[model samples]
Target: MVLNELGARINSALQALSKEPVIDDKAVDALLREICGALLESDVNVRLVHNLRQNVKKRVNLDELAASGNKRKVIQLAVFDELCSLVDPGVQPWKPRKGKPNVVMFVGLQGSGKTTSCTKLAAYYKRKGLKVGLVCADTFRAGAFDQLKQNAARAHIPYYGSYAEADPVQIAMDGVAQFKGSKFELIIVDTSGRHKQETELFAEMEQIAAAIKPDNTIFVMDGTIGQAADAQARAFKESVDIGSIIITKMDGHAKGGGAISAVAATGSPIEFIGTGEHVHDLDPFSARPFVSKMLGMGDISGLVETVKDMQLEKNEDMMKNLAKGVFTLKDMRDQLQTILKMGPLNKLMGMVPGMSPEMMQGFDADESTRRLRSYMSVFDSMTEAELNSDGKLFDTESRLRRVARGSGVRPVEIQALLHQHQQFGQIVKKMGGPKGMLGKMNPGMMQQMAKNPGAMNPNMLKQMGGMGGIQNMMKQMGGMGGIQNMMKQMMGGGDGPGGPGGMGNMQDMMAQMMNGMGGMGGLGGLGGMGGMGGGRR
Candidate 1:
């Protein structure tokens, strides 16, 4: 089964239990059975799934819990904890420190995406302000160095390799020495991908490791390997320390459950997962958040981290205009650009509280990306005055036609862009007036709000339609259960009544939470832009 389908099945079983009028052992057993079945079908190890079942049963005493009430909550929590345990080995993965060279070695079977993942990891660290370098030590595979070179060049990361250096060990040592001497903070050595039966290659791997003494050795496992991932992980772990694992090809219809479950065999944490082929497709993996997103609960913390990593809050002009309720076309364009930078649309949607994978089924990520790019093209063709203006300059047919001609976009598409900008402008207008939420807040509070929307006070809650209003909105979103719990966790309520800050921060929080989400394609507006014809030039 696909990973999303596995999540959906497990979620469906949980939802079924939630609907039960009476909590009973039979219902709990049914839920566990369904969940276990999903895991097994997804190629997860049977032993792990069985242990998960027994563990949940041990934690939840439905009979005793019946006396205390909230039986469902106890059972749900138990399941969540057990699922988290399946992937977490209780060992913290190695981390690279600045001002020193952190050597990271890559090892995996050929075709497990080891080379690609090396570049992705380098790119990920580079994005975080680390001076990273790549060393291709895979002399066994033809074009491996070229692949790394092209990928490194495209990502603008420094690299070290040689066509004449047939000795992989020498290459690894020379590369590490070169980068370390150059003061690169993170030096990643990509080793030749080998099989378990390749004794000489395994010996060479150990030699390379001994030569460089890497701080962290990541085992790149193919998600599609299914149950075989367990043996492969064990094999690689035996060969090296296997400080961490990075599962690749997760974006495809791979049996990711097996790869995730394989973490138990190696006793290493999954440092990252490659979601796609893009240089920015790597996601830092945390077990709880991974399962939460898989189960459609969303990862608010991950979303917050992504936003902070992008430093979206540094746009002082946009923040000032937002405070004054004056959103211009330029601001809208800037948002679209940020969204494009934030990675795939489906990935962003998964970080939202209510956007389940099932809900995302109809949204084509490629189409949405194309539409966003076309909108950008439309903005690109506009004059400086029009871009800085409130988009009303396009009211004249002549101006619209001229822009349409220049941008190769239909006039209607430009009109659609204007309409979307107008909607955002209206929302901004509501935020700035004397009676508006921003108007009531001081500059310090506004800055705090931007930094953490979940920290809003009760007065701010009243400004945004109250707790009831937020719950109603979440319900209207998809009728998916557990949104309230998700919201509470997002707000750092930690099992409090009505969550932290009374749900007042939901609207303004979501608005400021993911500037990319609110600003990108205007939430639902991107879907309505059918074809976005003639805007591709």
Candidate 2:
């Protein structure tokens, strides 16, 4: 089974347990059986699966908990905790310091995506304002330096490599020295891939490590390797001190559980996982959030962090407009643009609560991207006056036709965009009145929520329609039919053949949900009104 299937099976088991009228031993045993079966099918080690079952059984004593009145909660928590422990190595991965050079060395067999991961890590740090540089030390593989060079250039990260340098150790030393001398904060050294039986190559790897001591030696393991990852990880650990691990190619239909469980057994924490082939696909690994997202229980903190990275709160004009409950056509355009920058649409949707992968069926990410770009074209064709206006100026057929001709889009599409803008405008208007949610919030409180979306204040939640309001919002997004309706509206009432709408509706629905929950404070950073108005841009 793949990771998604594994998560779904485990979730189904937990839901079954939740539905049981009586939490009996039989039900608990059935739950354990289901979870263990899923894990084993996903290539998780038999021994680890047994241990997880035993641990959950020991943790949840049904008879003892019968008096607690929360037996279901206890049992579910035990399962969640054990699953987290199954993947966690209990070791903290090394972090790079800001002022000094932190060397990260990559090691794995050939075809493990080491070179790409190096560039991904560099890009990740580069986005965080760190001076990161890449070093291509893989002289063993043909065209290794070229691959690293092309990747580095695409990511715009500085790199050092040699076409003539045949000695991998020498290249590693020289590259590290050059980047360190240049005062680069994070220097990643990519070494040649080697197998366990290759004694000579292992010796060469040891020589390179001696030349330039890496602050963190990451074992880049292929997630598709299944249970064999355990032995490979142990072999690499025995050869050199592997400080951390990065499991690559996890986005596919690979049986990744075995690799993850195997690596965790080696006591080297997984620092990151390559989710896709894209240069920005490396996601920092956190055991809890990983399991939560896998179980379709959205990672709110992770979502907030992603939004924070975009620095949407820095858009002063957008924030001010939102405070006054104003969402103009230009604001909608900017939000769409920000969504385009926020990476894959499916990935974003996965971060939201109640948005399970099953609910995202038929959502085409690439098509949604094209549709968003098309909307941008329509916005570009509009005059500044129209962009700043409340979208009423486009009511004239001539004006609509002029924009449609200019943008090369159907008039219906432009009308769709205008209608979407009107919906947002109405929501913003409600938030502006004296009795509105935004009107009730103080400026300082709004700024605080904007800065840290995850840390929602209790008073803010109460003022913004409280938990009850959030529950109602969730109901609107809980079903496929609800999501389909929202998509239809955003896609201009299915104007295109077979309805071109996709996850693009998620942005609008999320914005509307935030508004319905009293104001745009909840998930506003992602909706687009800067930090606390619409949603993430």
Candidate 3:
């Protein structure tokens, strides 16, 4: 029934051609018409879609497929491949070199999150333990300084913006100079958003770049703009060395593909993406997933990346625990916590192949994750033997009693966790890590995760089993617990380069995850939730 969409769309257009082997002018025209409608409805750029149709018509050998009785099937594959090629599978937003202090210059129409992103970038770099500096060069807007200043405060980094300075370029120059010889390894300039007419402002930005000679220049655009992305990206590209782009407001945009597709022509890679106004809402942009969705295909690579990036340095602990073939109540707690770090689990799951959108429509992703997290908290209250060793929680009576006395949760919740862990055990047992840690991990991201901590779920932590809980956790981990324990819990079993112990503690993970997610100012929903783990909902 489901294949009917792609199947039916193809068949309806092929009826006349299917009856005859050679698809002449009429049949070819008909097939193109069907595809054109589908592409246009999906919010694809009209001219782009038209161009694609022309290419497909010229290339596809309709007569051969019709003769083989597989015209529709062959046609679908061709359309899919062409569409995929159009999207460009592996375009990353921004991947600055290790030691290069990437100067990601932010640009957008007014109120598209430039100031917010600047602080987020500063925090991202800071968490990486890189010396980070901020330049509030957006002197044009009424309250740009106040806005950017507020964000800088959230990140707890230094910033230079002058109300009297008037010249944005000068402010950037001063900001760049102030951090010289200091710890900050990365410098982000928060420039004011302007219209195409502002050539003077563009020249000023050139002056700033000439002064700083930034490693990367990022263009921040609102995700809601769709096809207009062409004009916006072009305007910025004309003025300076626009190296990358960031698409913001993704959490709310309904027709976001235009903005997603428009920048391909600019020769500028989209580096960071903003989902919301929150600082942690920023993520490195990858084009594969966005492209796959447009063609109605699943995006497996994004899932792999999210899982690899989400787990900080602690997935090793999970692997080690799994390798030992052990699953404790504590391990269950940690597993659930790890899932939180892995992010809105179901959404991440949706990126996997065969994960149907219709299937997701039935199951509420956020609510289910919340239920699972609560179950994990309940399991956390059990004794060491109950958590670590087998048979301690074997009896249903013990499970019920443990649930009631410890986390104020129900027995049913505990039952579910144990059941799920059993399933997980079976799954892990079947998996063979071909490259082992090298197979499952992203080296750069893993390194960053080791340094950054997940955000705090104030309400969850406050309500779940109470104060000094983190202290208790630290004690259980024997003083080394805190973040290292969490990271070990994250990457414990993995043989990745980012294995723990080298990772410092919560302070580091916090800075890093904050910087990676959206830093202090962008701690909204899943962004900050990535760090909260046990505290996260």
Candidate 4:
């Protein structure tokens, strides 16, 4: 991940404070404000940010901590703890009932993963030794029943539905009846997603939901939808008692933030996430890792738990910030911390489909951290005029010099900070709107990143993580020490027009081949197993 503005902000603030002998309130306030801003940018909810800021401030009283015999080291620990606490770290075990077809209904607008979700859920339960059945009730959309049928067949589950029946409620009722006393113990009802706006269809949907009285209701959603999650979720939430959600197509480039996190603002929790098109990709949802990914942080709860079952409450806090467009320096800094937590810069960014190793190479983590510390110093020295007017620093050379003097960095470094901020601002603008070339810049973003040299900074990564097309697994892997060395051993370093050959066009073919396997772990032992010449993972 490129160190975009958000990461820069957090890194700068954190570094500055890390050097301090005492935890100054002034410094904390600036850092908190920076965090507040970044959280908002990520489209997080407002009240949460307000709560986060207040809580962080309350816990960061250097005088209090110091008086309590808390050392400077502990102060940083307290900071991280306070923030992590806000995110609520923990995992929820899947609590399936003892008996009966734990009736799960997957619902969402058209094209959401409802159809595929039914099959995935069925397969999950089937593996658990429960006989699962499927009922397709989508009469409005053509071929919806067929799709469900095919998926059910693939899952090796019994399915009951009729295109001939007009009443979906009857079909659902019959599905349960047919499964009764049979081998199937769990029955999933697949309903066609009719937008909440469609009165007649929605009415039928409501009737169907009522008739089934499902044990769990899952709303499937596409991941590309960003801050609009609240509105979209609110649209469907009122009609049915939404038990949970399944975020689909996350394997695609779309940011899984909104889809997986509709619960963030809507008060609904996610139950499943579609990892890929294949049968095994449906994953149970908790919240920790998904939220951690959104914040560009590590899975504090542990990787396996996050991958298996997701909810970690603090996710609610993070999502609230992203929805509101408050990308704070602190939030940026936290992401930088995440990078450190995840290892080397290039390897971290390498996991992103669009992020080239070259871009990762361009980032000098030490220099960047040092520059960020210097940047924070400059910001610290800024007068109210400069703080309110980010652009004014450009014309106010003497003032800028004063900032430089106060921060103990050269005047030019302050200028460089200003330049970085400008580039950061442009990238943010692009991210806020069409994102045009800037949006696609990270991996597919390469061509775009080339046009905008500024896109390689901290802010871009934060926003792109929101925009999608990258694997957050890299962020975690990079920070975790062993993973990097492991990945280094795993990385193919040769040339075969693909693999490590660095040929761009062949990457897709390579990606497909890689996807075929469970993961890169299998390749770790092979330094030279493939036909290519570079390093083999």
Candidate 5:
């Protein structure tokens, strides 16, 4: 079974136990059986699955627990703990020291995405205010340096490589020395790979590892390798003390369970997982969240991290402008870009409670991204004065035609963009008036809210807006379960909760923005949108 199917099966097993009239050993055995079957079907090692089942069964003794101790909850926790242990080696992951030049060496077989992974790692750190540099030391693979150079350039990361350099060790030494002199904090060296393990491959890898004295040597494994990942990881670990692992192509792989679990066998914690072909698709691996997602529980921690990583609080001026209901076409453009930078829409959606990566496929995430780009294109075509003004500029047919022509889009499309802007304006108007719903939100609570929306007390939600804020919104939308159903319908291109009559798109967009704002003081920056409608004229 695919990972999603495995998750559903495991969830069903747990739900079955919850529904049992009385907790009993038979029910527990049945639940464990179901879970084992699902894991085995997903290509998880049969022996590992057996161990998980035995461990859970041993811990969940229904008779040993008092009536006060919930048997169902205990069983569930046992399952979660075992699953986490399966992927976690109980080892500390290597960290990059800020002041020093931390050299990270990447190793893997051919087609394991090592070169691309190097760039993705560099890009991840570069966004975190680090001076990241890349070194192309993979001379064994023809055009490896060229590929790294191109990726580094696209990500705007400085890199060192010589087309004439034939010796990998010499190239690695020179590149490290150069980047160290430049005071680059994170220097990633991409090394060569072979199709299969050979003495020569291991020898070269050992040589490079010794020459660079990297802080971390990461083994990049192909997620589709199934149980074979264990052997590959062990082979690499034996050749060089692989400090970490990164499983690649997980988005399309069915044996991700096998790949991830196998890495633990090599005693190395997985640092990241490549979810897609994009450079930003690399996700920092956290065992609890990974197991949580696998069991159909959303990655709440990951969602919060993504929001905090955006550093939305740093835009104090924009937040102030938003509080005054002064949202402009420029502000809208910035938000659109921020949404893009927030990572893949599907990935973000999967972080929501009751949502899964499989279910997110229906969101037409790629289409949503394309739509945002088209809207931004129109914004780009507008004159500075026009962008800074309200929707009045678009009211002039001549101006509409000019922007449409410049953006190479139809006037009707431009009109659609304006309609979206108008919807946002109305939302702001409703929430930012003198007695606006969002006026009472506390700026100090923004960070706390972003960390975990579910933990936000009802009073705090009420302060952000009337009717208990997000809690009320979730209730009216039928809670997370109802939200899933509504999303499925919306994904099918039907009208949303705001009805089919023009308000459907606006309702969806507002819900989206609210969801994104969950941890950002729950609408702290949206306090001043009431003046937006007035600004347009």
Candidate 6:
């Protein structure tokens, strides 16, 4: 099983037990067996999988537990905790200070995506408004500098590399000194990789480390290597101070579990995981959110970070208009643009609480993007007044005919787009008002939002799938806790005036929840605003 399949398998096992009235030893053993099988199949270290199974079983302790114990919750929590421990080495990753230059060195095998990972890391920090520069010291590879130069140019990031230099150590020293002298805050040095572990490779790696003295030396392991990742990571670690790890090529790698477990064995924390070929596909590794995503529980923090990274908080006018449930053709176009900026549709879907990767397989990214473009074209064909209106002008036959002819699309397609707009507007309108349902939602995020003016208004919540999305989220949070109580649980089960992080009150919690929602660049998927109810009338 792959990572997605592994999570689905565990979720299925737990879901089966969730439906049972009585939790017996036989059922518990069966569930553990299924989970263990999934983990083993995913190429997790066999010993680690065994330890996890035993730990979960020991913690459950069905024989000693009283009748008062909620057996299901106890088992679920145990599984959750053990799963978190699977990849967590219980260590802190390297943190870069704001005012100082943090030189990070990248190392891995020849085909382990070390160069691309370096560029991706640079892009990650670049998106955070940091002064980042890339240094290509992999002179051993034929086109290493060219590749890094091209990637750096495409991302508009400043880079330092020497095409004439054959010595990686000299180039690394020069690059680091140059970037540091320029006051670059995050400078990444890319090192060469050999076909196999050799003395020359280790010597050069150690020389580069000594030359630049990087604050973090990340071992970029290829996730497709299965159990071999353990040996490979250990070889690199024996040569240098491997401060962190970044597992690459996990998008569809069945053996990704092995690489992750292998890193855990080396006692190095995983800083990130590359999920796709794009620079933005690099995700910061967080244990709980990763496990939650694996179990179909969603990664709320990842979603929020994506939103904040996009700087969506600057759109105050958009929030105000959305709160009024006032959506026009122009607003739809803006939403479509935001969706495009947020990245792939399937990726966005995987971030939602109840959305599974399997469920999102049906969404063809290219087809959907073309469809969004067609809708934008239709809007372009409309008059300025019509575009700004609530699409009521399209109700007339002549108006429809004119737009269809102007946009070179069928009349029915135009009607379908209009109908979708109407549905969206209606949903938004029904979400909240001065005396409506907005008062009853997750208050923690809402509290966070209250501090940031225009980050999330009541109207914006309506724009985020209205009540349907919230209900779906509540259902995924075990259905019985309700929004307020679930908010409490999400806030680390705290009480009194403030919850975790000094949340002022229930209103503050709601604000925080709202802020999180607003920061979700993939809000369209989370709110169920996708599909638009079909393509044609």
Top lDDT hit: 2
Which window of 10 residues has the lowest lDDT sum in candidate 6? 528-537
| Model 6 ranges off by over 4 Å | 381-383, 396-409, 431-537
lDDT of 1: 0.74
- Per-residue CA lDDT of model 5 for 266-304, tens digit only, reads 799888988888988999887777767665566656665
Clashing pairs in 1: 461-504
Highest TM-score model number: 2
Total clashes in model 6, counting residue pairs 3 or more apart in sequence or in different chains: 23
Ranking by lDDT: 2, 1, 5, 6, 3, 4
lDDT of 6 by residue, 398-419 (tens): 8889888888877766665666
Q: Candidate 3: where are CA atoms >4 Å away?
A: 1-31, 38-44, 64-74, 85-94, 119-131, 149-165, 198-200, 277-280, 293-296, 310-321, 362-365, 394-399, 422-537
The per-candidate count of clashes, in order, stands at 1, 11, 44, 76, 5, 23
- CA deviation > 4 Å runs, candidate 5: 65-69, 195-197, 325-330, 381-427, 441-486, 494-520, 523-537
> Over the full model, what C-alpha lDDT does candidate 6 score relative to the true structure?
0.69
RMSD of candidate 3 to the truth, in angstroms, is 14.0
Report lDDT (Cα) of residue 147, candidate 5. Answer: 94
- Candidate 2, residues 220-246: lDDT per residue as tens digits? 988888888778888888888999999
Please write out the lDDT profile of model 4 over residues 95-119, one tens digit for every residue: 4574655677778888777788789
> Which stretches of model 4 miss by more than 4 angstroms?
1-22, 67-94, 252-261, 289-480, 495-537
Please, what is the whole-model Cα lDDT of each candidate in the order they appear?
A: 0.74, 0.76, 0.54, 0.52, 0.71, 0.69
Candidate 4: minimum summed lDDT over ten consecutive residues — where?
Answer: 513-522
For each candidate in turn, give its C-alpha RMSD to the true structure in angstroms.
9.0, 4.6, 14.0, 22.0, 6.7, 10.2
TM-score of each: 0.86, 0.90, 0.67, 0.54, 0.84, 0.81
TM-score of 6: 0.81
